[model samples]
Target: MTGGPTLPALPPSLRAPLGLVAVLAALVVSVIGTLYAGHSQPGRVDRWIVSPTADPVGPPWRPVALTLDFLGEPAGSVLLVGVVVAVCLLLRRPRAAVLTVAGVALAVGTTTLLKQLVGRTIHGPDNLSYPSGHTTFFTALGLALALLATDRLGLGRTAGTSLVLCVALLAGAAMGWAEVALGAHYPTDALGGWCTALAVVPATAWLVDRAADRLESAGRPEPR
Candidate 1:
């Protein structure tokens, strides 16, 4: 499994701080999500950003928003992940391919579970909308790619952290905007979803690395 390209090592300098930030941000977002549980109206932050309405954004950008929103849909996500995984395999970065799948799956799954637990709804009673799963999905993908890039390029702490965060922020914001503009989620829901991905991906990456290491160690032949 750890055959080609030496399996880019997760930078020791970048791991701890990123993990800490993710944990703290997730906690804060969760708390805010709790505050608006079972609510139908937009909170102050959500209203300030944009009102909760069907088709909050109009023409010109509407198509663009829909395109982005589709990327979070089942077929879109599968296609997106499949492309990245294929690329990783082509590059002989198996661990990276694994991370991409695991990170995204974990991030999206976390949001789904949180939606049920938080019970924050919008538009309709049965429509759960605490954390924006679309935002979480895109952010997770970006984070996985960022981590792979950082490791492959051997970036230092500052650079790696910056790269990961920048990618995550851009991805999350893009999808979040789409979700909110379409009135599919509240702005705060988007924020929570973004933070959820930020919290989940890094930890998932670390776990992937750890499991790979264990497998490699177990497969190693004893020295004579």
Candidate 2:
């Protein structure tokens, strides 16, 4: 933990563009991957992503499998809610916090509705599995955190933050991959989740921050 050399931080303005690019790429990949997996080889991909294939002699679960189950499950949302609440309290941005919570609800609800509306089968089981829940959760979390990190880093050097944001977003994608890899969902399902995250994360970040200080005069509070 202590051995890594300190990395110079990059500027947020530069980092923001890169982050946007990454998000766009992830969304694209997720979309294509999902569509291909479900539409072309649903049975095969489903088996690959869903069916358990562990060592014959050892335990039934791999670490990755266990980890996926833990994060992708419904319970993760409660934990996410807790984190958001804590972060909002810490930042003293109640409205932004409220927006984040609302965003999550809307995201999850929309995902569910879309899944049903799309009538995309869950592949192996009777489950409705478009838009991997874990992927969405992680994407949303990463987007929020990335925005927060960028704000803190400002328009100055933030290579350190950049690295951190990369890892965070990748981790979220990894979770989605796990779901798809395990056949719990299709790649498109994950992609859909990622898309939802992208569509709203920036807006939520703005909501959380409200108006920039530039809008109001420096010396006076606008209102009570």
Candidate 3:
């Protein structure tokens, strides 16, 4: 989606900081929400969200449900990250590739830790369901892909970002819905997972940009 001619592209310096702050805020809210949900007694919202999907609604949604579930698995997560990294490298954006991989890894690790720490229970046998690992991985991957598309693919600031945001929201909603339908997580768990990704990906990108700038500066010749 192209913006109007009057729409100005944000400078990299400003964009990075703003994105980081927004993501951090999301992470904080997600963390607090998850903790509250875990500690509080199961309420109407939790029941209402999980009930419809507890048992399969029909045959039509089965395939989509299965696909989304699979995509959130470790193998699926790895594949998604690999594809994003490969795309970035193919675009000759090594920093993007590195940042994507690192960001995903950090997000996954943090989610795992939070799951154990929070110890949120769902209908499933697994007790560590506070934040859905699958959702976290996929969300992070989506964000990384969006960043690459905007920064490297020359898709323009507005169009590329808007496209990526739409894709990421769809992907995240699908994954979260599938998890709930399968009785693997509560709605809050999925929210927490998204929050984790929001926090990690932008922070990682900012760090990568800073590191790249430092390296570039170091490699420059000294003025005589």
Best by TM-score: 1
How far in Å is the alpha carbon of 27 misplaced in model 3? 5.2
Best candidate per lDDT, number? Answer: 1
Instruction: Tell me the TM-score of model 2.
Output: 0.62
Output the better candidate (1/2) by TM-score. Answer: 1
Model 3 alpha-carbon drift over 4 Å, by segment: 1-42, 52-54, 124-126, 153-161
Question: How do all the candidates rank in terms of lDDT, highest first?
Answer: 1, 3, 2
Candidate 1's displacement at residue 64, Å, is 0.5
Give each prediction's root-mean-square deviation over alpha carbons: 2.1, 7.4, 5.4
Global CA lDDT of candidate 3, please?
A: 0.69
Question: For each candidate, what is the lDDT?
Answer: 0.86, 0.56, 0.69
| Stretches of candidate 2 exceeding 4 Å from the true structure | 1-61, 93-96, 155-168, 207-224
Off by over 4 Å in 1: 1-9, 52-55
Clash pairs, model 1 backbone: none
Per-model TM-score on C-alpha atoms: 0.94, 0.62, 0.80
Give per-residue CA lDDT, model 2, range 6-109, as digits (tens): 21122235446545754675566456545543342354544564444532222453467557657646786677677876885576544445555765666666
